[model samples]
Target: MNSALEILTKYWKHDAFRKPQEAIIASVLEGKDTFALMPTGGGKSICFQVPGMMKEGICLVISPLIALMRDQVQNLQNKGIKAIALTGGIHSDEIIDLLDNCQFGNYKFLYLSPERLQNDWILERIKNLPVNLIAIDEAHCVSQWGHDFRPAYLKIVQLKEYFPKVPFLALTASATPRVKEDIMVQLKLDNPQIFTKSFYRDNIAYMVFETEDKLHLLQQILQKNPQPSIIYVTNRKSCNETVHQLESLGFTATFYHGGLSSKDKEKHMQLWMNEKVQVMVATNAFGMGIDKANVKTIIHLHLPQNLENYYQESGRAGRNGDKAFAVLLNNPSDILHAEAQFISVLPDKKFLNLVFTKLCNYFQIAYGEGIDEQFSFNLNHFCTKYSFPTLKTYNALQFLDRQGIITLSQEFSEKITLQFIIPSKEVIRYMSLNPNDEEILLTMLRTYPGIYDMQTAFNLQLIAKKSNHTENEVLSLLQKLKEKNIIEMMAKSNDATITLNEIREDERTINRVSKYLEAQNKLKTEQLQAVLQYSKDTKSCKNKVLMQYFGESLAADCGICSYCISKNRKKQNPETVSDKIVELLKIQDFNSRDIQKLTKLPKDDVIFALQKLLEDETISINSNNLYSLK
Candidate 1:
């Protein structure tokens, strides 16, 4: 067998392992359960991939993110390594064939979701494979204390029953002490070797700015940096608006959100990655599995819900170890907004029960009989029918999804099914009567073979393309046809698909997951409060604050963070500070806050300098409370 370094050199082209990766890989190769807690961009994947490559049999890896799994599988395959991800949307027969390939096709790696372990047949098939290693990525999800906990992860421990002797390697980029402990216990890691790299990023300067005009601050920062960067927003609307704002200011920018099609996401990502665009204004969906080494900054236009998410997102910068910045722009209103977006939407037991009961009723799922059933769920329609608030109902459904009660696929699309109720000759005659609608009706007729015999689903875009009309035009013509009783049409706007993961017991179903829901909601509240405290903090070293949150401590302050820089500024001569304030006042009337922002000094120092200038009769406050030259 090749050494881990040899495998790394051959496949990854890395000369050596990073930090404790070598040690962790050695432990895994020695048939010992291992836990590696490395920070983001800390080379965590190598810890398992190298050891798995060195071993003889297929390495079974479990992850919660489908995108991450697909990305990793693609990366491995690009390296000429045999790997496959059994994510969702795969047919059972295909999964069986893939498992058989893993058994007999000499495949080196098999990636799958933790939820896949719930299938007994797959488990039985996996039991017979010569699995040399079991790797769990994002292992923190196994713990209830984790920020992104998934109940499906709790089922991952069942693999131990099948592969009792297989070494399980668990890896996560961020985990608290509590979460770390829970991961080990939940994974049943026996006497596991634990390796934790410090969360400190020496090259990153964490900064938080309080500003009412966030757009101005954003422009200033981007202008100063003028390098590849990511500006994170809270929603899709913000993504587009920020991009437009940047474009109007002569900045080359693009945006990415979950709502974007795969093609558009790839196009935007490529534009940013190739440096064709200077900035990527995106939601949190854009960064997973992306390994850009020279992102100069990660800026948050709004407050993050938790420090864990903030840390992971900000850590994207400076991967090549050059100086970079992680900036958070905040205002007084951001706190209230964060609370509303994160805390207020949390579904309690009552809300969960209501959503659960209503969902089953909405789908007409009889009591105790909805397992594995799928339905096209139109969230807006459902909400309007029940007079439920949209966001709250969506959150409730998400909670149900996280609990593995129902699998919600939020891939929005318009579903239209239609059939010609009249005879073919009558339909042709009616189409000829309406000359304007002739092309679209004929296009639908040609596109769907069984439209006249039965209600057939069709792509509106394809119909529009074939008929030389826009989707809206085609939809309008279809509505006209329905009005004229030429056809039976059923149209619904669906943003998600609901797959029942468990039998319908109504409230009983929700009652089973109530404890977890309550605990997670409380945790979310605490996490949000911590984030608010972090934003409001001005005296603490920003880097130290983040490190401490992740259960690490530093003996010295990071000299580059905003707090440290401000502290250093405070030590400047008072007269020099006053001179700078006077020069700013020389330009125009300015308030103390504006002076502090312009001078990049501490609040007290700015106030002291302003007082000194006033005392010296060099500047005076006008009726508007702005200081000017006297």
Candidate 2:
């Protein structure tokens, strides 16, 4: 432990291991199968990383999130640790080279996506590597009942046979007991050490508001709360809509969702991280590896599919242990809409069969011939061409992924740049004729690596702008260099990573998977309705009810929520009109403009209400900013 902290200080700046991290690290080092249930900021990665540093062989980490894998690998490299994530989008030769590096180059960690388990050649290569530990991130996905279960996770269990002596460690931030048990069964853990952190977060206040006008309620929360907040809506369009609304309401807002281009997503994320954007309106796709510690609030415009998702998103707030609020804005129709979304994705067997045949046709493979072909799909365009419902077709594809028909990875793209292939001496010799051109060429050589290995993809316009040359000049120079065998260049296209299975699935198999998916969708709809039931319960504390749903028995009333406030005010006032007025004010401050925008009520009525408030001095408005008694 002394050497550990010394290395930690020498490299990572921290002197002590976070709570539960040391124990998990020690267990893994002792060659024990460990299952860790820690919160978001609980230092889960250190449990495997520290032990990997102390062990004799590499630790192969299986993660389900590509963005998370990229971020963690980059961070590890930044700390001078050797780590690699062999996910989709890379060429097959690159994967083979990385595997060879892991086996012979003394790489300590090789992070892989779960879908990569389907690659038999890669598995064969990994089977020969000296893997001391297998770490599975987001282990809850093994459970069918879990919120984000991926079918590829089940194939991970086969690696246990390849390395019988190696210990397996599973980790997840959110899971019910059922999910935990499913994880154990899926991984085939043998009396593994199970560690669970208490789910109770005493510092975060949970609040839910029932209202017809949610945008106004959202504005009120933002005005009163501190910065570095997140607002979650149901879809990409809603994320944009909410951001526009907030911007009009005089707040700095940016939107994010999976549908955005990778460059756009990264730009928005960087802006938010730099505090240039005070609030982000996004779908649930954001915030897996985002580690901003001072987020003060999370507002949900629609109910999440389950508590696991809600908890994971809300947990992003108050990570620095300060006070924060997790508020949900709900209307009666919101639950119905969420339910409809769940139902829309349950594909019928007929559609599933159609998708299977269409996929084979599109790839130009016969029924029995698509064994080793790799192809990318555009789901919306594919469905539009075939006249199938897009959402239902996507669901069917997911079912196919589950049935081992094909691997459908979530969409991801990254900005990668590289430059020329000549040795420095020859380049310098060529550049000695013109010092200015030599300087620019030498600058490219010094800044980027792996330039000589293959055709380099880079932005020609940016390079020309920096070099003060025309785009045509740059192109001609690059072309001349390539013809001289001094460089090779290939720009990256918008390519999706995918691998198809060898066997064509029969109609029977498709039908079986479809039935199972439909059943699962039905269960999800029911669970969502159950959460809505808890939300509508007026007799219980909102926090207590939510905690109880996650199996907490002694959870108490949260005194700050709408239900609690309403109860206390009802007992004191005994006047319905006064309580209604106060609740309405909590939703929004009504001035002439707000009233005119919303209601058909006469201006006299609105003016009378404002005068009454001014007379009592209970509220005031000036220059569109509203205020209540401080």
- Which candidate ranks first by lDDT, i.e. highest? 1
lDDT value for model 2: 0.75
Q: Whole-model Cα lDDT per candidate?
A: 0.87, 0.75
Q: Which stretches of candidate 1 lie above 4 Å from their native place?
A: 376-378, 411-452, 455-495, 570-630
Best by TM-score: 1
What is the model-wide C-alpha lDDT for candidate 1? Answer: 0.87
State each candidate's clash count.
Answer: 0, 1
TM-score of each: 0.83, 0.78
Residue 437 of candidate 1: its Cα lDDT? 83
Residue 322, model 1, lDDT: 98
Residue 330 of model 2, lDDT score: 87
Predicted candidate 1 versus true structure: per-residue lDDT over 1-630, tens digit per residue? 788889999999989888999999889988999999998888878888898888889999998777788889989999999998887555577799899899999999999977778878888999999999999999998899999888889888888888888999999998988899999999899999999999999999999988777888888899999999999999888999999999999999999986665557889999999999999999888798889999999999999979999999999999999999999999999988998888898888998898888888999989979776667778878999998887789888878877777777666556788888889999888867788888888888777878989988767766886788987798888888789898899877676678787788987887788989888989999999889988889899998888888888999999999889888863768888888887887788887768888998766778887888788898889888899998
Report the C-alpha lDDT of model 2 over 12-113, residue by residue, as the tens digit. Answer: 688798777777877777788899988776778877877777777898999867778888898888988888899655567768888888999888899998
Tell me the lDDT of model 1 at 249: 92
Q: State the TM-score for model 1.
A: 0.83
Task: Give candidate 1's error at residue 403 in angstroms.
Answer: 1.4
Candidate 2 local lDDT, residue 355: 83
